[model samples]
Target: MAECDAEWELCKENIQPLRQGRSVSALHQALCQQQEGNHTALNQQKQSVHQTSRLYFTFESELRLYDGDDPLDVWVRCGLLG
Candidate 1:
Protein backbone atom coordinates (compact mmCIF):
# COMPACT_ATOMS: atom_id res chain seq x y z
CA MET A 1 0.00 0.00 0.00
CA ALA A 2 2.77 2.35 0.95
CA GLU A 3 4.62 1.45 -2.23
CA CYS A 4 1.57 2.16 -4.37
CA ASP A 5 0.98 5.49 -2.65
CA ALA A 6 4.64 6.39 -3.08
CA GLU A 7 4.51 5.55 -6.77
CA TRP A 8 1.33 7.60 -7.23
CA GLU A 9 2.86 10.53 -5.40
CA LEU A 10 6.00 10.33 -7.51
CA CYS A 11 3.94 10.29 -10.68
CA LYS A 12 1.86 13.28 -9.52
CA GLU A 13 5.01 15.22 -8.64
CA ASN A 14 6.47 14.57 -12.06
CA ILE A 15 3.23 15.45 -13.84
CA GLN A 16 2.23 18.48 -11.77
CA PRO A 17 4.28 21.00 -13.69
CA LEU A 18 2.94 19.93 -17.06
CA ARG A 19 -0.60 19.96 -15.71
CA GLN A 20 -0.13 23.49 -14.45
CA GLY A 21 1.30 24.62 -17.75
CA ARG A 22 -0.51 25.06 -21.07
CA SER A 23 0.81 21.73 -22.30
CA VAL A 24 -2.04 19.83 -20.73
CA SER A 25 -4.59 22.03 -22.41
CA ALA A 26 -2.83 21.75 -25.69
CA LEU A 27 -2.63 18.00 -25.35
CA HIS A 28 -6.32 17.88 -24.55
CA GLN A 29 -7.09 20.01 -27.57
CA ALA A 30 -5.00 17.80 -29.78
CA LEU A 31 -6.74 14.74 -28.48
CA CYS A 32 -10.17 16.29 -28.94
CA GLN A 33 -9.55 17.62 -32.42
CA GLN A 34 -11.51 15.33 -34.70
CA GLN A 35 -14.19 15.07 -37.36
CA GLU A 36 -17.90 15.38 -36.67
CA GLY A 37 -18.55 11.65 -36.82
CA ASN A 38 -15.46 10.71 -34.87
CA HIS A 39 -15.81 8.76 -31.63
CA THR A 40 -12.92 10.51 -29.91
CA ALA A 41 -15.21 13.07 -28.27
CA LEU A 42 -17.42 10.49 -26.63
CA ASN A 43 -14.44 8.34 -25.71
CA GLN A 44 -12.67 11.27 -24.10
CA GLN A 45 -15.72 12.20 -22.05
CA LYS A 46 -16.14 8.63 -20.82
CA GLN A 47 -12.46 8.39 -19.97
CA SER A 48 -12.35 11.72 -18.16
CA VAL A 49 -14.96 10.71 -15.61
CA HIS A 50 -16.01 7.08 -15.54
CA GLN A 51 -12.73 5.46 -16.50
CA THR A 52 -10.68 7.64 -14.15
CA SER A 53 -12.92 6.90 -11.19
CA ARG A 54 -12.89 3.19 -11.98
CA LEU A 55 -9.10 3.15 -12.13
CA TYR A 56 -8.80 4.97 -8.80
CA PHE A 57 -11.14 2.51 -7.09
CA THR A 58 -9.30 -0.39 -8.69
CA PHE A 59 -5.98 0.85 -7.30
CA GLU A 60 -7.45 1.15 -3.81
CA SER A 61 -8.86 -2.37 -4.03
CA GLU A 62 -5.49 -3.73 -5.15
CA LEU A 63 -4.00 -2.78 -1.76
CA ARG A 64 -6.16 -5.42 -0.10
CA LEU A 65 -4.41 -8.11 -2.12
CA TYR A 66 -1.15 -7.41 -0.27
CA ASP A 67 -2.60 -8.18 3.16
CA GLY A 68 -1.86 -11.91 3.17
CA ASP A 69 -0.09 -14.40 0.97
CA ASP A 70 1.52 -13.63 -2.37
CA PRO A 71 -1.05 -12.63 -5.04
CA LEU A 72 0.29 -14.89 -7.75
CA ASP A 73 -1.82 -17.84 -8.90
CA VAL A 74 0.90 -20.34 -8.00
CA TRP A 75 0.26 -19.69 -4.29
CA VAL A 76 -3.44 -20.64 -4.46
CA ARG A 77 -4.37 -24.25 -3.65
CA CYS A 78 -7.64 -26.23 -3.92
CA GLY A 79 -7.33 -27.99 -0.59
CA LEU A 80 -3.97 -28.65 1.12
CA LEU A 81 -0.58 -28.44 -0.46
CA GLY A 82 0.98 -30.98 1.92
Candidate 2:
Protein backbone atom coordinates (compact mmCIF):
# COMPACT_ATOMS: atom_id res chain seq x y z
CA MET A 1 0.00 0.00 0.00
CA ALA A 2 2.86 2.38 0.77
CA GLU A 3 4.48 1.54 -2.57
CA CYS A 4 1.23 2.29 -4.31
CA ASP A 5 0.96 5.57 -2.40
CA ALA A 6 4.44 6.52 -3.59
CA GLU A 7 3.41 5.74 -7.16
CA TRP A 8 0.34 7.95 -6.66
CA GLU A 9 2.58 10.79 -5.51
CA LEU A 10 4.71 10.33 -8.62
CA CYS A 11 1.58 10.41 -10.75
CA LYS A 12 0.48 13.68 -9.08
CA GLU A 13 3.92 15.18 -9.74
CA ASN A 14 3.76 14.12 -13.40
CA ILE A 15 0.29 15.68 -13.81
CA GLN A 16 1.24 19.08 -12.37
CA PRO A 17 2.56 20.40 -15.65
CA LEU A 18 -0.54 19.38 -17.61
CA ARG A 19 -2.85 21.80 -15.80
CA GLN A 20 -3.06 25.13 -17.58
CA GLY A 21 -5.99 27.16 -16.22
CA ARG A 22 -7.05 24.45 -13.80
CA SER A 23 -6.88 25.14 -10.04
CA VAL A 24 -4.32 23.17 -8.06
CA SER A 25 -7.03 22.40 -5.51
CA ALA A 26 -9.25 20.94 -8.21
CA LEU A 27 -6.42 18.75 -9.41
CA HIS A 28 -5.75 17.67 -5.85
CA GLN A 29 -9.42 16.77 -5.35
CA ALA A 30 -9.47 14.70 -8.54
CA LEU A 31 -6.30 12.86 -7.53
CA CYS A 32 -7.68 12.18 -4.07
CA GLN A 33 -10.91 10.88 -5.54
CA GLN A 34 -9.04 8.50 -7.87
CA GLN A 35 -6.20 7.30 -5.63
CA GLU A 36 -6.73 3.61 -4.84
CA GLY A 37 -10.52 3.92 -4.99
CA ASN A 38 -10.95 6.59 -2.33
CA HIS A 39 -14.02 7.92 -4.08
CA THR A 40 -17.79 7.62 -3.54
CA ALA A 41 -18.31 6.33 -7.08
CA LEU A 42 -16.17 3.29 -6.38
CA ASN A 43 -18.18 2.35 -3.30
CA GLN A 44 -21.41 2.83 -5.17
CA GLN A 45 -20.14 0.64 -8.00
CA LYS A 46 -19.05 -2.06 -5.54
CA GLN A 47 -22.44 -2.08 -3.86
CA SER A 48 -24.14 -2.27 -7.24
CA VAL A 49 -21.98 -5.19 -8.28
CA HIS A 50 -22.60 -7.05 -5.03
CA GLN A 51 -26.36 -6.65 -5.31
CA THR A 52 -26.29 -7.76 -8.95
CA SER A 53 -24.25 -10.88 -8.23
CA ARG A 54 -26.45 -11.84 -5.29
CA LEU A 55 -29.53 -11.51 -7.43
CA TYR A 56 -27.90 -13.50 -10.23
CA PHE A 57 -26.89 -16.47 -8.06
CA THR A 58 -30.17 -16.49 -6.14
CA PHE A 59 -32.10 -16.86 -9.37
CA GLU A 60 -31.09 -20.36 -10.37
CA SER A 61 -33.94 -20.59 -12.87
CA GLU A 62 -32.11 -18.20 -15.20
CA LEU A 63 -28.82 -20.05 -14.65
CA ARG A 64 -30.42 -23.26 -15.85
CA LEU A 65 -28.79 -23.21 -19.28
CA TYR A 66 -29.76 -26.74 -20.33
CA ASP A 67 -33.26 -27.74 -21.34
CA GLY A 68 -33.92 -30.77 -19.11
CA ASP A 69 -33.95 -31.02 -15.32
CA ASP A 70 -30.49 -30.66 -13.69
CA PRO A 71 -29.70 -32.79 -10.60
CA LEU A 72 -27.01 -30.34 -9.53
CA ASP A 73 -29.66 -27.70 -8.91
CA VAL A 74 -31.19 -29.85 -6.20
CA TRP A 75 -27.95 -30.10 -4.20
CA VAL A 76 -27.07 -26.47 -4.79
CA ARG A 77 -30.54 -25.28 -3.85
CA CYS A 78 -30.45 -27.43 -0.72
CA GLY A 79 -27.26 -25.70 0.37
CA LEU A 80 -28.45 -22.24 -0.60
CA LEU A 81 -31.89 -22.67 0.92
CA GLY A 82 -30.42 -23.99 4.17
Candidate 3:
Protein backbone atom coordinates (compact mmCIF):
# COMPACT_ATOMS: atom_id res chain seq x y z
CA MET A 1 0.00 0.00 0.00
CA ALA A 2 2.82 2.37 0.85
CA GLU A 3 4.51 1.59 -2.45
CA CYS A 4 1.26 2.28 -4.30
CA ASP A 5 0.91 5.56 -2.39
CA ALA A 6 4.42 6.56 -3.35
CA GLU A 7 3.77 5.75 -7.00
CA TRP A 8 0.49 7.65 -6.91
CA GLU A 9 2.26 10.70 -5.53
CA LEU A 10 4.81 10.52 -8.30
CA CYS A 11 2.13 10.30 -11.00
CA LYS A 12 -0.36 12.77 -9.53
CA GLU A 13 1.00 15.55 -11.66
CA ASN A 14 -0.06 13.62 -14.78
CA ILE A 15 -3.68 13.57 -13.69
CA GLN A 16 -5.75 16.48 -14.87
CA PRO A 17 -6.50 18.80 -11.98
CA LEU A 18 -10.09 19.45 -11.09
CA ARG A 19 -11.38 22.50 -9.26
CA GLN A 20 -10.16 21.12 -5.93
CA GLY A 21 -8.01 18.32 -7.33
CA ARG A 22 -8.92 14.63 -7.44
CA SER A 23 -9.11 12.46 -4.36
CA VAL A 24 -6.22 10.02 -4.13
CA SER A 25 -8.41 7.46 -2.41
CA ALA A 26 -11.12 7.81 -5.04
CA LEU A 27 -8.61 7.29 -7.81
CA HIS A 28 -7.25 4.24 -6.07
CA GLN A 29 -10.72 2.74 -5.67
CA ALA A 30 -11.45 3.45 -9.31
CA LEU A 31 -8.34 1.60 -10.39
CA CYS A 32 -9.17 -1.31 -8.15
CA GLN A 33 -12.71 -1.51 -9.48
CA GLN A 34 -11.45 -1.47 -13.04
CA GLN A 35 -8.99 -4.24 -12.33
CA GLU A 36 -11.66 -6.34 -10.61
CA GLY A 37 -14.29 -5.63 -13.31
CA ASN A 38 -16.62 -4.09 -10.76
CA HIS A 39 -18.94 -1.21 -11.25
CA THR A 40 -18.18 2.02 -9.43
CA ALA A 41 -20.30 3.02 -6.45
CA LEU A 42 -20.69 6.51 -7.82
CA ASN A 43 -22.35 5.21 -10.96
CA GLN A 44 -24.74 3.12 -8.90
CA GLN A 45 -25.67 6.16 -6.87
CA LYS A 46 -26.19 8.20 -9.98
CA GLN A 47 -28.54 5.57 -11.33
CA SER A 48 -30.46 5.43 -8.08
CA VAL A 49 -30.81 9.17 -7.92
CA HIS A 50 -32.02 9.27 -11.48
CA GLN A 51 -34.62 6.59 -10.88
CA THR A 52 -35.85 7.95 -7.52
CA SER A 53 -35.62 11.62 -8.40
CA ARG A 54 -34.31 12.21 -4.91
CA LEU A 55 -31.24 14.24 -4.11
CA TYR A 56 -28.38 12.68 -2.23
CA PHE A 57 -24.92 13.97 -1.55
CA THR A 58 -21.94 11.92 -2.61
CA PHE A 59 -18.35 11.51 -1.46
CA GLU A 60 -17.25 13.80 -4.24
CA SER A 61 -19.70 16.46 -3.14
CA GLU A 62 -18.08 16.58 0.28
CA LEU A 63 -14.87 17.73 -1.37
CA ARG A 64 -16.51 20.45 -3.38
CA LEU A 65 -15.89 24.10 -2.56
CA TYR A 66 -19.24 25.03 -4.10
CA ASP A 67 -22.50 23.22 -4.74
CA GLY A 68 -23.58 24.84 -7.98
CA ASP A 69 -20.99 23.14 -10.15
CA ASP A 70 -21.22 19.44 -10.96
CA PRO A 71 -18.67 17.30 -9.12
CA LEU A 72 -18.75 14.68 -11.87
CA ASP A 73 -16.53 16.75 -14.12
CA VAL A 74 -13.44 15.28 -12.57
CA TRP A 75 -14.69 11.77 -13.02
CA VAL A 76 -15.78 12.55 -16.54
CA ARG A 77 -12.30 13.69 -17.41
CA CYS A 78 -10.87 10.57 -15.90
CA GLY A 79 -13.45 8.44 -17.80
CA LEU A 80 -14.87 7.19 -14.55
CA LEU A 81 -18.25 8.93 -14.71
CA GLY A 82 -20.25 5.94 -15.72
Candidate 4:
Protein backbone atom coordinates (compact mmCIF):
# COMPACT_ATOMS: atom_id res chain seq x y z
CA MET A 1 0.00 0.00 0.00
CA ALA A 2 2.81 2.38 0.82
CA GLU A 3 4.49 1.48 -2.44
CA CYS A 4 1.30 2.17 -4.36
CA ASP A 5 0.92 5.54 -2.62
CA ALA A 6 4.51 6.42 -3.38
CA GLU A 7 4.06 5.51 -7.04
CA TRP A 8 0.95 7.69 -7.26
CA GLU A 9 2.84 10.57 -5.64
CA LEU A 10 5.66 10.14 -8.13
CA CYS A 11 3.21 10.27 -11.03
CA LYS A 12 1.63 13.47 -9.67
CA GLU A 13 5.07 15.02 -9.16
CA ASN A 14 5.99 14.36 -12.78
CA ILE A 15 2.75 15.90 -14.03
CA GLN A 16 3.11 18.93 -11.75
CA PRO A 17 6.08 20.30 -13.69
CA LEU A 18 4.12 20.24 -16.94
CA ARG A 19 1.14 21.86 -15.26
CA GLN A 20 3.22 24.78 -14.02
CA GLY A 21 4.18 26.64 -17.19
CA ARG A 22 7.21 28.83 -17.77
CA SER A 23 5.55 31.86 -19.43
CA VAL A 24 2.12 33.49 -19.83
CA SER A 25 1.14 32.11 -23.23
CA ALA A 26 3.06 28.98 -22.50
CA LEU A 27 1.09 28.66 -19.29
CA HIS A 28 -2.18 29.20 -21.11
CA GLN A 29 -1.29 26.65 -23.74
CA ALA A 30 -0.12 24.26 -21.11
CA LEU A 31 -3.29 24.72 -19.14
CA CYS A 32 -5.44 24.12 -22.19
CA GLN A 33 -3.41 21.14 -23.27
CA GLN A 34 -3.50 19.78 -19.75
CA GLN A 35 -7.26 20.05 -19.61
CA GLU A 36 -7.66 18.25 -22.91
CA GLY A 37 -5.10 15.63 -22.01
CA ASN A 38 -6.73 15.11 -18.64
CA HIS A 39 -10.11 14.59 -20.22
CA THR A 40 -8.70 11.99 -22.57
CA ALA A 41 -6.73 10.27 -19.83
CA LEU A 42 -9.71 10.25 -17.50
CA ASN A 43 -11.86 8.61 -20.14
CA GLN A 44 -9.23 6.02 -20.88
CA GLN A 45 -8.69 5.29 -17.21
CA LYS A 46 -12.39 4.92 -16.58
CA GLN A 47 -12.77 2.50 -19.47
CA SER A 48 -9.76 0.53 -18.36
CA VAL A 49 -11.06 0.27 -14.80
CA HIS A 50 -14.47 -0.80 -16.05
CA GLN A 51 -13.02 -3.43 -18.32
CA THR A 52 -10.75 -4.74 -15.60
CA SER A 53 -13.59 -4.96 -13.14
CA ARG A 54 -15.73 -6.80 -15.63
CA LEU A 55 -12.98 -9.27 -16.36
CA TYR A 56 -12.44 -9.87 -12.65
CA PHE A 57 -16.12 -10.44 -12.03
CA THR A 58 -16.30 -12.82 -14.93
CA PHE A 59 -13.32 -14.77 -13.69
CA GLU A 60 -14.75 -14.97 -10.18
CA SER A 61 -18.09 -16.15 -11.50
CA GLU A 62 -16.39 -18.81 -13.56
CA LEU A 63 -14.38 -19.95 -10.58
CA ARG A 64 -17.48 -20.19 -8.50
CA LEU A 65 -19.16 -22.23 -11.18
CA TYR A 66 -16.25 -24.71 -11.00
CA ASP A 67 -16.73 -24.88 -7.22
CA GLY A 68 -13.01 -25.19 -6.51
CA ASP A 69 -12.71 -23.94 -2.94
CA ASP A 70 -9.49 -22.24 -1.88
CA PRO A 71 -8.69 -19.81 0.92
CA LEU A 72 -6.44 -17.71 -1.33
CA ASP A 73 -9.17 -17.28 -3.92
CA VAL A 74 -10.58 -14.32 -2.08
CA TRP A 75 -7.23 -12.50 -2.06
CA VAL A 76 -6.62 -13.32 -5.69
CA ARG A 77 -10.11 -12.16 -6.53
CA CYS A 78 -9.66 -8.88 -4.67
CA GLY A 79 -6.34 -8.24 -6.39
CA LEU A 80 -7.98 -8.61 -9.76
CA LEU A 81 -10.99 -6.55 -8.66
CA GLY A 82 -8.67 -3.70 -7.71
Best by TM-score: 4
Q: Give candidate 2 regions above 4 Å deviation.
A: 1-30, 33-38, 61-82
Candidate 3 ranges beyond 4 A from true positions: 1-17, 38-82
- Cα-based TM-score, every candidate: 0.27, 0.33, 0.24, 0.45
Candidate 3 clash pair list: none
lDDT of 4 at 28: 92
> Least lDDT summed over 10 consecutive residues: which range in candidate 2?
73-82
Of 2 and 3, the candidate ahead on TM-score is 2
RMSD (Å) of each candidate, 1 decimal = 17.4, 9.9, 21.9, 12.4
Q: How many backbone clashes does candidate 3 have?
A: 0
lDDT by residue for model 2 over 1-82, one digit each (tens)?
A: 9999988887775444544577889879888878857667788999999987887676665456535477556446536543
- Model 4 agreement with the true structure over 1-82: per-residue lDDT tens digits: 9999988877774444646566788779989999999999999999999999897888777666665567567557656434
Residue pairs with backbone overlap in model 4: none
Model 3 residue 38 CA deviation (Å) reads 8.5
Q: How many backbone clashes does candidate 4 have?
A: 0
Please give the distance, in angstroms, between residue 8's alpha carbon in candidate 4 and its true position after superposition: 25
Off by over 4 Å in 4: 1-29, 67-82
**lDDT of each prediction vs. the true structure?**
0.60, 0.69, 0.65, 0.77
